[model samples]
Target: MTKEQQAQLSQQGVEALDKLLKETVENRVLPATYFGVTGPEGELYYSCAGEKVFGKPEAGQVDPETTVQLFSMTKFVTSLAALQLVEQGKIAVDDPSVIEKHLPELWAQSIITGWTDDGEPQLVPRKNPLTLRHLLTHTSGLGYAFLRPDVLERYEKKEGLKGFLEANIGVEGYVRPLLFEPGTHYAYGTGVDWAGILVMRLTGQTLDEYFHEHIFGPLGIGKEEITFLPTEQVKERLQSMAARTSATKGHIILHPGWRNVAKMTPEMIGLQSGGAGMVGTLRAYLKFLAGILKCQQPGGIISPQTFELVFSDQMPEGKQPRKDLADFLEFMGVTDKQQTEGKVTHSLGLCYLANGSDDGPLPGSARWSGVAKTHYFVDPKAGIAAICGTNIMEEVPTQFLEVYSKFQRTVYDNLVQSKL
Candidate 1:
């Protein structure tokens, strides 16, 4: 397509996405939402809707400049930092001894077998050594206590341990018994946090500092735009988080958990929580995603070989972990009708779809989401990256999901499919 034709189609796509975002906010599907799309060069489209604070007209509308909690989206940055270390030959993803040397505490964790008759936890030593690959792939056997309520109850009631949020007392907060043996299955949990710790131990730099010197510095992103600790200025623009009273309520109230978390001092939130700690503006995040998309070509952030590995499936072949990875994709609802065990796999830091359908991202795409309903995807085959940012807590509502899916489809239908 000619440049003029392409620009016209892109503008049409932006209008469609803008209409969707505005409608979602008008219908109270979300208190605030922002969406952006980029290619290897730079941004293709951007839009936002709703107020920064729910039910408060004076709070102003959320825009690309609004800072919001990134939650687990922080994993993508953490994983990239760890991968950079690998490129420098400071660490190896496949080597267990490197992890053992750097983060011995994580390597020494035991697998939880079952509960004894007395309600005590039964534990067994791990047979396979922990590796960076296992941690990055979510196959390290660590998982959140909330996901396993029996374990949570045993730890909190029987053993008198604090809950996950209450236990935000540094790296120790994530230290728990393994849910399965290392390299045996996929369980999303504290593995990325451990990887962050490994990066800190080896480089002697906090995640924030390391990112500033490396990732942000190279991309020209300011410290105020994206950070583990928001400045006073960034805090002023921070978007309020909300939760639906019920799916039927169709409206949002300030999320109770957000209020508690907002009150936490840095001392209270001791660890940087590489898995879910950072906050940033949508504009800055889109730049970062665009840089990642550039990695598909020459002269990118990391070496082309390293980028290939980062996007490739790291799971072992003919293993139960691959099956577990397939189950994870299905559970996340990212798979199409053509999805099968062989077609879906876990890349270093994202879910890889070997045969993505035309309705969404193309084949050879990597995607993931945050706990607060934020979503992003990088499609190498399509040469595009996109993000949908929101501040809603709890499970994603069906209305929001439908809108998000439509936004992605509209993006491809105009920017990609039209070019074909």
Candidate 2:
């Protein structure tokens, strides 16, 4: 991007941040907010909380560099790590049978023939086998407690996802029955957590070790640069963390399922949550995310061929729509169209791509939200990507899309008006 264009993007980003902070303070969103937008080369905007609600900042205002816990955002990172393996020819996206050898416990049961999980209603037999593509895109039918409490409770009754996975991959190696058949539905569970452990077993590297060696180290992300502040550091970032979130509303706040289990020992929580447990500044994430955006647009890290391999829809050739949303936004950031008619509820991943149907536009926007309020979108047609992160979780809409969408409209109008 030209320096002049870069300045415009930066100006718009700061302006949007200011507006977002205002909304949060007026009780429109949450108390604190961290947001940013970046291209492969430069950050358009890098910002932090407007003010403190839980306490006061020890220093000046919070820096956008302060780390915020990345909930499901870790899924994208996990996917990237898996992609790296694919690049090395270590794994095949089309083979679910690989789980048979490395994840035999997954095959020990009847393979979840019936259905009780909300994410997977049918629980049909494996649809042409549950390939690596199925797991990465959330079609593996692995259920989580996030949306469906009852189903998660049953899985928990089975000693929770972390335990089930550890038992299977760890010493005992016993696989849990699928709540539904593979490739049948879209449910957000610890499936990638299972993937992270798969990385551990296949490479003999724990999730942390693998991420550090392959991902964090190469990317220049370090202990101080990226943090899921342990108890000790919590006090240091506590004020900001507390400021960034609101009280848990009517549900399990963050669902640290591994909290009581062996996999989530304090140290392990920081290490293995390759699926959910990450903390970093928006700028740091911008670097990681920008690479993904470019790679997805087939411009940054991976080749265009590898991009298609990892993100192309993986449903069985003649399979019916298992997801209500159209495409997995897959780290494209958020989209300008989500609040518009374009927000696809059923997708292969985090993106929406104008699926031409009367069902409307549930398929055109690249969108992903952290289990918490951290949400991202990048609309290729719309020209840029934006991410907003806060530790808060709420049942009611915080009106983030409302403000975000308005900003997009403002920019588009301003640009158009200037042309006139």
Candidate 3:
């Protein structure tokens, strides 16, 4: 944090990013990329690279205002909403009965025991109760089918299960059986979507309304910056989704999801998935993150106590991701080293990975990404929150990870320049 260190970091950051930017133009990771960095003090850096849409020369380039589908990054916003409710004392983070009391329909849930002898679905009653804490920490036993296809197979057997890609957003998509008993496992799932529903049920305001009234409005954000469902106007500002074509070259190709997203109608707005249904500009979303970072200080979105709780470890007591689960997650493009990494854990509101000890992300830092390669990390100790995003389908492809890894190292190296 010294002036000399800041100057060195700035130089190193530019050098590292310059190489990555060239690769981006060469289609190394994405066709379009937008990124921002902030701290409790304010904006640090913001930049964009590549075209707005692949193969559309006349379209445009990315910028701070260019909007992109946040995908699972929406969970950060939903987490904030839930934590706000906790700050208000309307909901208890640790109360097991809070979920059942507000959303009784979830009471009849079952855990996926195993497949039956005839390939039928096997189910068992969950012994432990689902709590607000469980939902916030992803210990509530809910999951997304796209990530874990094994659960998707079981969910497909149920009648009336619709693909949410172009369909209406609803809790029905997440109403499937639990992957394990509540409070027993660490799985990335739709618990936050349910938490969003809890916010609506308690406040009688839609998640959109609740965020605007509480988080956005108080923080001085406009409605245009963050749109849950892509309206026509929102669609206009969106950086088109680029599909990855090759592993080595990061070849640029157009994907159908971009067209589908462009044509999203108002009807698709129903039942917002607090887990995935949201889109916004990089600067706007960074502002929201700045709010979370500011919460580490006094006079922010939530109380300081709540902020500490949000960033602290919330994993099952003395438990980590099972080896099989960690393998499955890594295979799905999410990095998990719970088995090999020392004392790995998750926070209540964010996916707290490693306690940064030696190198890389500082200890107790929280981070997560979207399906389309959008990623963000907040290091409270480092006084830095960085967001790097590209409208590329599939999460953290190898080439993208290479670029991301370099960016992350440069950021941390600059912050702690003495390491060099």
Candidate 4:
């Protein structure tokens, strides 16, 4: 679609999207809103809960402008920041010497580690040094065990979770222990967080500062309600966010002070995390994606080359697709299996699923769902994108996957059926 049409898609897509909103709201999910932009073949979006959200633009509301916490979707932004640093020769994607310059503690604390083929744990002397590339690709062997019992115990005692977050709000504290040797496996822990710290160190800027100077600064976002703003300033924004969280009321684990927006505490490190933090409107978020989707050259928020790298498969070599697929499904509770035993069916790091050998979200669509059920899709080949956000979490939230899959399929079929 032309630029004019793309802009219009937000207006046009909303009609259908509004239908989606009602369906969600009527289910008794909390207040929800979507600020999405649809390009011909790509989209960028962010969501926030607002008073009477996405229902109608309220007076002085600027609903589309207010920023909402992106949670893990910030990984995409964090990834972009790292790639930008690489583009400027400020950081090497795979250099170990740079590791010490930025994080001296991690240089010593982490023992090279991995898992054995027998499903037993193993350790190895890291053959190669960890680099920015390793972290961004999530192949740096870092792991988070909070999801498991024995592992969480070992991780907390050895790594110290609160201590970890305190020291390495972004990178400094997180770089401590290597869960495994660099490049040997993909565990998807604080590697991206480390990347955020790397951006800070290389650019001599804080995470928020770097994002504004390099990213948000260019996008003309934050035009309405502020996102990635400090907690002290988020009362209005938090109230907005609190509105959309109806689905996960019982099950979703959120930032502690989320309930009493007025009583939130401040953190020392207000860094924008690559793994899970950043607030934005769905429209602003989609604008970000549209630039990438339509990028024909080296520079548009991120260099095109770097964009390719971020989206490429980052898992370690050689594993059954079913193993990872099951991992992804199990993470979403779509299966009765565990990650190790699951199939290698999907891509990691916010990219599209590979059709799960004809069983997943189609062949060339990349999607990510937030902890709160905010989801966005990028369809490069098909020229389609969709975003759905609700304040509540589903008991079996994965069900929405089928709902969205059908939406995409409908779009595809309707197009073809018309041609026929």
Q: Which candidate is the best by TM-score?
A: 1
How many angstroms is residue 146 displaced in model 4 relative to the true structure, after the best TM-score fit? Answer: 2.2
TM-score, model 3 to reference:
0.89
Error of 1 at 401 (Å): 1.5
Regions of candidate 4 where Cα sits further than 4 Å from its true position: 4-15, 29-37, 40-62, 112-125, 157-176, 223-226, 231-233, 239-262, 265-272, 320-322, 334-349, 354-364, 392-396, 399-420
Per-residue lDDT tens digits of candidate 2, residues 328-386? 22222233333234234333334334442121212344556665567766544333556
Prediction 1 TM-score vs. true: 0.92
Q: What is the C-alpha RMSD of each candidate to the true structure, in Å?
A: 2.9, 6.4, 3.5, 6.1
Q: Per-residue lDDT for 1-420 in model 3, tens only?
A: 333322124666766666666676665456677656777656666777777877786898766778888878888788888888888889898787787799776767888877877777788988987888788877778776766677655566554586554467466655778888887776777788888888889989887888888888878878888877567777888888777654524556777553366878868767877888788887888888877877866788888888777678766664544333345456755443441344455677776655562336777787778878888888877777888778777544876766676677766776543342
| lDDT (C-alpha, whole model) for all candidates | 0.77, 0.52, 0.72, 0.53
In order of appearance, the predictions have TM-scores of 0.92, 0.73, 0.89, 0.74
The residue-level lDDT of candidate 1 at 8 comes to 27
RMSD to the native, candidate 3? 3.5
Measured by lDDT, the strongest candidate is 1
Ranking by TM-score: 1, 3, 4, 2
